[model samples]
Target: MNGSEFARPIVGLTTYLQQAQTSVWDVHASFLPGVYIKGVTLAGGIATLLPPQPVDAEIAARVLDRLDGLIITGGKDVDPATYGHDPHPTTDEPARDRDAWEFALLAGALRRHLPVLGICRGAQLLNVALGGTLHQHLPDILGHTRHQQGNAVFSTSTVHTVEGSKLAGLIGETSDAQCYHHQAIDRLGDGLVVCARDTDGVIEAVEMPGHDFVLAVQWHPEETLDDLRLFAGLVEAARNHTTERVNLWPPPN
Candidate 1:
């Protein structure tokens, strides 16, 4: 069957676990922005929300067994402790459970060779998962707040992708990125290569070599729904993965 004829790939998205109030109900909830869902659907993939939960390697593996791809969505700051650093004064309080949950899921996804995309905080987590460090606060280093303009505000950045990198091939060598990240990758992660960077020299994207699709960007691509190139690329890779799995172990007729 051709690509269009294949079943819609199941793309799992990690969500934020926080206190939310709706309809007179105030309680902790697992929720993600609608833009992320729309982005996945528009890219021709089935969206599945994976909230923060108690997950180990075994549990994560079971979850991956059902997904064709994984998206580590943007959210709160990752605990600096995970990378052997004390919390910066400007850093938001850490979401330890979410961090642990995502790390486990990421480990399983990597072991299973699943197509994975990370955005904003997702990008930072991916780097930390690979034994990398973060700058904690970009404003402190850049002497400006351009990377994170203000409360609930996203700034535009001129991002330059490395030539020949997967990210460059998908979004071109230069693109205006929607960014809202205060922390960024400080030390290079093992097996991960920088694929994109901002004009100010901040790492904007990274990917693990030899992986089918393991791209992570510091920008919030979901904010720009009009450009579905990144999402489409992920769904396409997921579709190919589905095809290969089916070929290797045909389903019962």
Candidate 2:
């Protein structure tokens, strides 16, 4: 089918804390737009935004039920306590509401086997949700340079080793991804396999074997939509998933 023929895949993004008057949780408009632009430019799908609050199981289920797939966007650091680690001296604890919201949404998506693409902090959230742990602080624990380079926003970094996994195929190689994070995964979660790592031995990508499409990356693919391949891969997966579901059960008459 042509790209437009497929339904626009709705993708949710987790928000961060903002100060409109007081501390209100919010996601940037560009966050979803960037992801959507990449998907449309590459695989011909659309994205719909979802808030990062009131993360009730029922609400999450409803949200996932409408979308063809989901994209968990990046944000602040996750609380180390969630992964059994003592709080890092340099760690910035993420908003508890944002964490709760994303966690609930992730749980709902997994239960339905919905295609998910998580970036940066979103990747860490996926890992923690699946029973994994995080390093809290890469420089302090892993003894690596600041991965969050300020000179170039969304710039590429050193190459990593792709372990013959789905992500390798998506990006075409274990080349340098757009690095922008200070944390890394420590203990892996249940059902997740480390797909890529950097020179410092940091877990850069994780995937679930036999899943519809549960891929999370430490890099920012949305920021690099010029490389439409990654977005194309995700949109294509969502399209195929939608087609399969329709074939299995036609819409109610």
Candidate 3:
């Protein structure tokens, strides 16, 4: 199908709540990768944003039912308890609301075989959702240089290793990425294969070879636009899935 023939895909972005006010919240929203849809749209694809918060299972399902793909954005550390562990001293308290909402959204997306792209905490959530665990605090246990570089905002770093992987093939070897988290994947979840890691052996990327399009990265791809191949891949995959579904069932007579 031509790009214009491809309908605009609604991408879901998970958000985080500010501590000060119960109602106040911040959506670590980004347009870097989202902008890729523009190119897709220009090429004939559509794109829309779906923020993750006040998650309603019914709403999530309805959204996923219509969306061609989903993108889970980065945020604070996930609670250790979700994966069966006491809270680590270094671990930040879990966002119960976000956790509950995202868990449902991920489950629904997976069940439907919709394409998913997870970034940072989104990656961790995917792991936890699939019965995996996290390191909680990298510096305390991993013995690696600070992954969360001293920057309140996003900070860019070098991602070494460019072998054979979807991510590597998309961005090539040695691409600059933003690091903003202290936690790393400890025990990989089921059906997930480590695709990329740092020199220190930290899991940077994970993929489900059997799934339609399940890819997760620990870095913030949305922080950089030049390397939006990842998002473009997702949009393309969604477009294909949508086409396949339509082809499987012709319009009513």
Candidate 4:
């Protein structure tokens, strides 16, 4: 409700490319579940859907040029080849197209230092893109499957936030969170630090300190309507970015 939200930043959310099925339609499409758009819009920002691209760096830069904030929404497993690892039998098939497209997008966003909020698979993709490795199968390492509930639903986990971390004020020091992930970050990436975790020590959130706003979480805030700080935080950061951009290049008198 402060002045930071006055600008109503345009937040670009990336989508998936796959076969979609509805009662009257079944076809290949580039799309995201409506939850992402709902979350951004409810948080006092304009949401825009960004379809996947075909590994084009120039296009990625042009896309970031217009976006004040970026959201890499969840999707299929990331390609292990991205981080020099081989596929695991338990790992879901990699979506190479999405991986490359998002990687390029992340690269562009990072170069511009734009605010970025990543969720679920988006978190994993951010990690991999920044030179981190993945466990590929959490059940194998933890001997439990609580992190991933079967079929289209989120499981609950008591997650603890790191004190003084960027997410502490938003997600709290300890809170029950909705989660659904089979893989997790193994070795963290460059410029990223853990901000929270579940009881089992699985990394829950990460942030790139000293950046305007670059954060990722294993859970999806967009799925729950009660939380808006996460999205609002990005919006505020984007507003600051917009102000800086305008000052750097004033319009002609």
Candidate 5:
């Protein structure tokens, strides 16, 4: 059967564990903002929340086996120690479980050759996971408060996408991007190329060429809620990938 004849492509999203409180219960729970899920759904993909992997062996690889795409979500700051750096005063405490889990998930997805999207903190995670470092604090480097407008809010910035880059092909060379992060890409990771940047020359988007799809952006695409181009690309790639996998299985057995 063709991919179009199948259910929506299953897109796995990495979530964070938070000490959540609600009218119903107060406990540590795995959760992600509805916006992320909503974005994937609106893009015609099936969204699955992938909480931190349990202690089972090969958890990430097993999960990757069932997933058509992977999304590493934005979250708390990555530990500076992971990338061999001294912590900056402004850096928040590390989301240890999330960092490790997402790293493994990314590795699994890469091995499986699945499309991956990394947003905001996820972009930083991609960099860190691929042997790169972060700036930790943008205010110190730029001496400005432009990248991050306010807490629990996003600042609008105009980023220039590289001409002829994959991102430019989808969203054009220039667009208004919704951004919220103090830490940005410092030393680029192996196999990653900058595709977009803000006026301050901060790296806003990165793409892993030669891969199916490995795009990470420092901005919040879910905030815009209208530009589904990137998400749609992921879904299409996932659909195509699912079709390929289904055809490859039971290899002449």
Candidate 6:
């Protein structure tokens, strides 16, 4: 392989494993929005789709062994039980398998210090994985459904980044985010600090301190297409990770 090809970081993106309808048949499928792949590629990383599957710490570690970074793409609501809560009446039915799979993958990534970027449901999952709780239904708390307009439509959110957060360094102080989530971060996760929030004070971004790179956002960066700062940041970190890995294993002269 050419130097450029070998240097390009391999980033694993989580996919939705669900019933899907296409061309001539409907079946349970593993799929992801093209925008997620576009974002990663446009930012100079090789996109690798990782569908939900039977996984444990060892399996997740093996998976991470081939990846330089991880992106937890948006999907179904995180099961409330994940964070020690009962399901809210409006909550989406549990995708326990996906939850378990992703939790394992994330644990492996964290252990490896791989860069991670979580979006929407992904952001919620990160919080839950780190011993945090979620609001479950924003409309009930905010008294409006502005964060999510329903029926697969995305709403615009003006999020202001925290002054000294890693996210602020990449996307500046403010960003017009494309959001489609009905739940928001409630209690802060362990070692996680809020990096951005909407006008309503709903947490929009969170990051784990002392990690190589672990940032998750409530908004959908892929949907915004115009802004790729978040994806670019992830790719840059992953590239650095790749460089470090190679240096640690020198090829014989």
lDDT of the candidates, in the order given? 0.93, 0.75, 0.75, 0.88, 0.89, 0.92
Model 1, which residues run further than 4 Å from truth? 2-5, 250-253
Candidate 2 at 223: error in angstroms?
2.2
The TM-score obtained by model 3 is 0.82
lDDT of 4 at 230: 90
- After superposition, the stretches of candidate 6 with alpha carbons farther than 4 Å from their true spots are 1-6, 250-253
lDDT of 3 by residue, 127-229 (tens): 9999899988888876654688655666566776447777777778877777788888989999888888776778888888778789998987766665567
The global Cα lDDT (0 to 1) of model 3 is 0.75
Prediction-by-prediction clash tally: 0, 0, 4, 0, 0, 0
Give the per-residue lDDT of model 1 (tens digit) for 1-253. Answer: 5553478999999999999999999999999999999999999999999999987888888999999999999999999999999999988899999999999999999988999999999899999999999999988999999998878899999999998999999999899999998899999889999999999999999998899999999998899999999999999999988888877775667
Best by TM-score: 1
The best-first sequence of candidates by TM-score reads: 1, 6, 5, 4, 2, 3
Q: Across residues 111-213, which tens digit of lDDT does each residue of candidate 4 receive?
A: 8999999999989999998999999999899998888877888898888988988889776788777898999999999989999899999998899999989
The superposed Cα distance between candidate 6 and the true structure at residue 107, in angstroms, equals 0.4
Which runs of model 3 end up more than 4 angstroms from their true locations?
1-5, 19-47, 51-58, 153-155, 160-162, 250-253
Q: How close is candidate 5 to the true structure, as a TM-score?
A: 0.96
Tens digit of per-residue lDDT, candidate 6, span 69-168: 9999998999998899999999999989999999999988987899999999989999999999999999999999999999998899899999989999
lDDT string for model 5 (22-103, tens) is 8999999999999999999999999999987553339877888889999998889999999999999989888788888888
Predicted structure with the largest lDDT when compared to the true one: 1
Off by over 4 Å in 5: 1-6, 55-57
Select the stronger candidate by lDDT from 1 and 2.
1
lDDT of 6 at 49: 92
TM-score of candidate 1 relative to the true fold = 0.96
Model 3, residue 71: C-alpha shift (Å): 0.7
User: How many pairs in model 3 have backbone atoms within 3 A of each other, for residues 3 or more apart or on separate chains, i.e. clashes?
Assistant: 4
Q: Which of 4 and 5 is ahead in lDDT?
A: 5
